[model samples]
Target chain A: MNKTIINRLLVNRNNNHLFKRTYSSVGNKIPRDPKYAVINSKDIDYFRSILKDPNQILTDKDDVDPFNCDWMKKFKGNSQLVVKPKTTEQVSKILSYCNEKKIAVVPQGGNTGLVGGSVPVHDEIILSLANMSKVESFDPITGVVTVQAGCILENIENYLVPLGYTVPIDLGAKGSCQIGGNASTNAGGIRLLRYGSLHGSILGVEAVLADGTVLDCLSTLRKDNTGYDLKQLFIGSEGTLGVITKLSFITPPKPTSVNVALFSCHSFDRVQQVLIRAKKQLGDILSAFEFMDRPCIDLVLKHQAGTREPFDDSTPFYVLMETSGFNEVHDGEKLSSFLESIMGDELIVDGSVATDSKNMTSFWKLRETITESLGKEGATYKYDLSLPIDQFYQLVAVMREKLDGKALVYGFGHVGDGNLHLNISTPNQSYSKDMLDMIEPFVYEYTSKHRGSISAEHGIGAMKSQHLHFSKSDPAIHLMKSIKHAMDPNNILNPYKVLPQ
Target chain B: MKIFVPVKRVIDYAAKIRVRPDKSGVDTNGVRMSTNPFDEIAIEEAVRLKEKGIAKEVVAITMGPKASEEVLRSSLAIGADQGVIVNTDKPLNPLSVAKLLQKLAETEKPNLIIMGKQAIDDDCNQTAQMLAGLLKWPQATFASKIEISESKDSVKVTREIDGGLETLSMKLPAIISCDLRLNEPRYAKLANIMKAKKVQLTTKTPEDLGVQLNENLKIVSVEEPAKRSGGSKVTTVDDIVASLKKHSLI
Candidate 1:
């Protein structure tokens, strides 16, 4: 038998046990797709020839383990080889060769994704984009930045902030998540209410298709009326259609003045009233409007260090309002007047304004760290949903009633965007299948009935691929499959993701 | 005991610099102005001394136009107890500044005075030395580390020299110029900035200090450094030698 066949046999023997374990979301054991080729010694030599650096080709079990698992630790793969390409040309050559050999490849950047989109499901080759981090160019006049796919989000922000500009997106994982991954997933963050979505801000993208054809759509112009916007397909394709190599996005000017105010609401209805009033009063200056329930705040105080309640008395809900503007005096006056109006109208029970940077950071932390604090409680069933603004907290209420004290159910997220992060966890900090079963189809059905998105910002990776039907129509999904087939006929790019099997 | 710290407002180090059209000096119009980074380190050290209970108060003083009061406010936000500004629109040299500071020192009578080794704009490392000379006090320059004695009458400073460190001990009422490794400055909190507006800031003129501006130096013109040209490729050692000979650099 050939050496490649022998290696494939060994890999199959090793993964035979994993095949018996079924995934909870898909409710089926995902067998290794037989069409994909396994990595052998010859394949490693080929990768080494293209990479030209021995350190870039990771074959040791210890070195490649981090790439094989995701940040959530929910999905693990058995990829035997990992390759880090330093240039777009190197990535092109590697992908072209892999396409010819019918080997599956997973393109990863930062590997901080909540979904298992960046990791391989089976013994596929891992294409890590860790070495291709560089800022190609930045137009100071136009405020457009062109950077490689592997640059960390926070690094780019720091680079632009001193120049009187900043990247429009801001996420909690900014210190680790890569800009390329952000564009690929169409990440919606706190600044979305002010700067809009990546679809509007990302001017151009350079990507390589499954056949190694370089699609150079990296245009820096704000307006391009040319035929089809081909780059939009790869924006949220989750690396299935192609690999995003570089991006050019417009950045917003850094705000000279920022003010934050935390408000305590008696009920969810009061929170909505406060939001309505804030939108009308703090018109062009409102940058963020986020909310968290009392339970969420309680968990943050219990788990997160150096966190305290913003008010003396506890309430049913809390709202964090942020404002950014150019004139400090004008913005400060506006924020104070808005606060006074809301308090006088009895829309809020209590409120506290952040008089300094320390208070501002602490107030934002109380809202931003809710997700991190929830992870400490137990195995959480996380859902990022987009629903009607009025019915935002109804699902959380329904789940809380359904679980009936068995699990802790709470809600928090960007209220300005109608996005809610509904989380459920047990008190014992263990993964329970019964709890997951009670949450899944019902959650999807409720979301579908409300005509809401089941997966709001987090893409439908291996976790929610089967549940995509709840949000997307049959015709829309059919067209998506056709597009995927037309772009990648061999299905060698990020298999078993985005599209349903 | 009280400590006096002198801060200077200069163009932000990160801002792009441009020369004036008349070649007189660098253009300052529309440029971001900030407290000299070294002076920020000096203010940080003084505030830390007060926090440690070694110094009872910190007084930040600056001499410039009215806009320079922003730097004094910043220092106040960073934990200075009081501020004093010598309001002067006319340009002042190192010697003129030293004379004004000497006049203030006679009345304030602070136990210690700390300042930056040099201003980034002029790079003139003379004000501290001149002040110490005029006051007849011991002086320590390029101080990377500082330690005050238990009795608080003397201090020890570790200076960063070319190849090694030098330690110097000075009596009370000494002058110390801070080096880059002294300490990292803290950002001014918003609450403190709001409160800094109410801090007592005394304003005085150069005439009020009984000092007349007398400058001994004059700058005829200012120009940017010459741009470097690209080098030619050489294939052999003889070619390199020929290139060097052509440029008269051999």
Candidate 2:
């Protein structure tokens, strides 16, 4: 069957059932807003009146329960009602009514996030964009896709494949994540190396304020130097400022040929050298350059079934390299020569080139499965930080040495973009305050010492709000709070998030 | 030894299938179709056999509409040395598909044939068995694990049965159907997809293959399963017990 036609024929029936879990086993410490008005029969009546479709208003516990938890299942909210509106007009009316009633609301998308950002914190109303999942428009000649905030990243990717275009953002969570959520969080993914960041690709953003004011600045242009590009504010606002409803982005044409290669390196410095050489040799085709430690891959092999160690002898580090271009023959020859040179220079101890798509996908799984593998091990103290490539693993090594095996600390991420996913794990699978206390100030101090960012790709949702000060100065944080207050005076739009108390 | 693998085009595994309102059959109006997943496993196995040097060439053949040529190209991208497409717009039942395959086997005369136990859609699980029966060849179905014998004249396969696994040894020119646990099929890389364009795909018609085209089984009517109502949430343990009691469950 034609892939384009087939792609459109069947929707994924599995994810809905897969996401349902018995109300989280996580503790009930996250607080609900006291200021927000409780739901009376009148409020429910008003909500029902606004949404013509009664089915869109989910009051049933089983149906609305999944929206109350984050992807990691680390946080849970006791939200009573969830509303999914199909149109921006409906969203505007729902928010307008909620605002008039002084009811707190949590704007949600795919609800796939490392931090407790998408789900409700308390019994606030859950305003979902689930029904607003359509590609509003697409220009084949310009390669710009204007999609509703609720459109899934993976679905858009498949949709664009026939048009010879690709989604600018690519992540492990692409299958379930919403582009609106990604843009709202300024999601930096594997494609960051090739396509820059969401901040660059997203040309315009359309959001609804807490007061139901539509900030309609969604534009589809290559260049716009208009005053005060307000879209940037909502790009990483974390829904604390407003609810993102739609967005327009410039997408790149799909590459005709692709190549994936895995290299084993002895040290971080050697990995850096390999990356520099690959960029110079592969040039514009270099899509990703990621590295993981022995411990990380070991965890993956132990946790993810069917995933084996790519190399017989374990090296200190492994780097997964990806390249894509227009010509397969040229790209293959270019990559083969680069691999030969790297081997000749002894920069890499051993390497494996994905001979086929099967091997290539498995190789990607080795790199992509790191998070799930870590999850299987135990409670992971996660940190997405940006540091110099030369000394990226130094933080992980320092933490590991300092922790003295009380917890396992490992580092892995997009090394090309200097985004290090520093993970401190409790192998015993029990989270304790003492462990957190030991890791925080020390890790923050170390990151600051290196002049690095505390939060790289993953935004400062509920989890890292307090730690924002470690990365930003008091004035910068004060300005963010001021913006938050100005945009959402009631603090009802995802209250107690993105900003520290 | 040369391996012949027959694959079918079906709705992708990731797709959520919904019965059309009229219930004629599965509504494939907008869904993305790809090579049947089980067939992918068979293709993976054939390619692996060729890679292992036990098999010299792997030929992937599919019978369907012109669009099924995409499935053949995908097979080639998955490592098939060549692809053959039997073009026909008409739908073929399992028996019809088997007979057409049988005619192709008479002319191709491959040493062995490998295919999926069944296409996920329809899921008759009859094609491989019927083909083997018509050809009078040894057959192994529901194969989870496969091993090439030293003689290379026979294959050792572990079949996943309901109760337990059963091991079987089958001779040359045998028909083997793949189960889910056999092996994970590799993705079709862009480079391979490009290379697949260069692969020799010979197109033939079912009529030219000298096979009778007749679909004996007719689908009466198609209807979607009744939608389950959303469950209610209870505040406490007593509420749950009371609801269960009200539903006459516990």
Candidate 3:
């Protein structure tokens, strides 16, 4: 039945001959990019007042430029209008009007996305969910929180923490990322090792379809077992499925005891050993398992002068681990005994554990500082890849050898989950292109060989679209395109993102 | 026709905000607060139409802390039919804010609702769009022109787009957000001050809305943008051209 629907759409495309044959030899064919004509000023005002009032729409280029791009600054596009609807009905009506006019609507959440998923890729109309950020319902007893998709992750976390509940997933971009975008991208944050994916915790999603129909699926049930699971289809569809307006999600209980520790390892082999021991000893209590290489530590020490590691001498690698349990001493004891057990193996050379909440935060600062430290480390090339925990460190070692001192390479992994951030830096602009071209394919090839993902967390925005095949299978790619075509058959929603052009 | 206008209180547009050294957030110290300028225009437009007798009533609502009443009072002072303030200290995003407003609108069922295009703070710009989605209402954004139908049940709107304009029409009970081009919002006067003080404001909390905050996304730090060093100013046309040529910006 779905294939028939796709065939019908394909036949329409074929009839018009709008599909371009030359697809740049990358991956997917470029269906003629959607054409967008500017909405007139008078029409802009008319649509503006159709909202609760005419005062909330942003149209001036200066006012909307920040909304047109994500934090990556890699994908930039122009949009003629930005619409903020205060209610779901308004969104439906707005979309219906846009559909009639053949005005492609790109839904945007928090523009902090690393992928260009949340921004316009053409002169399409930008339908912002900014005004839709309202808490509709919460059942503390059931541990479910329902909110509009545009709510800031940090804001939601702050609200839940004080109430003895917490947003299960946490990431560095939480403050800037919206819940809708988080759900849309199926964001795997630092806490994914503990909370799992949104596919489990996200109870339901209310989305606006292409024809302005509202898919009202905001149910707070843990197990629906419904036929087809329509909500799951939109979770990681990257807004190609529909514009997520609201979400019902399950929140985890706030941990009573939290301990963070940073350890220095002399070898990548030892680092993996320590991670295995920590996971085994800590069990479910282990919340985060982060790995950092020597170059990463060196960059931090150089850029952030006051910050220092516990080791007297520079080590080849460092590991930061956090464990949250019901009892502070029990968790501490487990962590200490694990360290002692590994001492004989010499998996860890030096380490420090946080005794208090303040100290725990202080310890985690080293891991969080990695993003900022990279800015100071020359012309840097960054790749966030997900591979087998065992092979992650080895890939970095191999890449370092391949660079042969032409560039410096650093590796870090969220060991609990298979995500690693590998950064390469060229000393000068003369070697930038070589470093990028050589490192990108080399890293992606290894990731593919190990059945790893090229984009672990930061999405396949314009930056990684060329290498999407490394992580995605041809069938997966075709299905993703079919989903995109099913909803935005006009090929309008964030064009040239996620899928190759 | 009765219109509902939503107002938001945010940091004053002109003020240069500084992030606290602790990396928590911007220091609100000496930071002036004001009605989000676009929302102020929304209130003004609604009140103007009411005064002209085109609108039978102008209701003003706000979603923020009690301090936001200052902005709400400005709306009431501008002659809104009444005021409702969802009193909560929680920092709401577009999704939650839209849900709360949708609930309020469901009860009141105003013929029209108006709000700023986007809040200055957070700047997610999701509220209006998501609200439209939730309420399933038609929306005209960045409106430069709005005309009520003779039947008073439909509206014709002009929206601002990049490089050009778009014209749209929809039945009443629609939503319209305002832009800078909408109108010059007027300041509240002393005469209306007494009237605004008496205006009732409704308050709601996160619990009231049945939603708790998602804490997974925490703020590690809020640092100020790195300051750029002062560049040589080219005031004269000759100097501007020379500087552009030197930088290859020409």
Measured by DockQ, the strongest candidate is: 2
- DockQ per candidate: 0.04, 0.06, 0.01
Candidate 2 vs candidate 3: the lDDT winner is: 2
Candidates in order, TM-scores: namely: 0.69, 0.70, 0.61
Candidate 3 off by > 4 Å: A1-34, A376-379, A427-435, B1-250
Clashing pairs in 1: A356-B190, A356-B191
CA-lDDT, candidates in order: 0.84, 0.82, 0.73
TM-score of candidate 1 against the unseen true structure: 0.69
CAPRI accuracy category, model 3: incorrect
RMSD (Cα, Å) of candidate 2? 8.9
Candidate achieving higher lDDT, 1 or 2: 1
Better of 1 and 3 by DockQ: 1
On the 0 to 100 scale, the lDDT of residue A199 in model 3 is 86
**Clash totals for all candidate models:** 2, 16, 113
Cα deviation at A343, candidate 3, in Å, is 2.1
Model 2 chain A is weakest, by summed lDDT over 10 consecutive residues, at A4-13
Candidate 1 runs further than 4 Å off? A1-29, B1-250
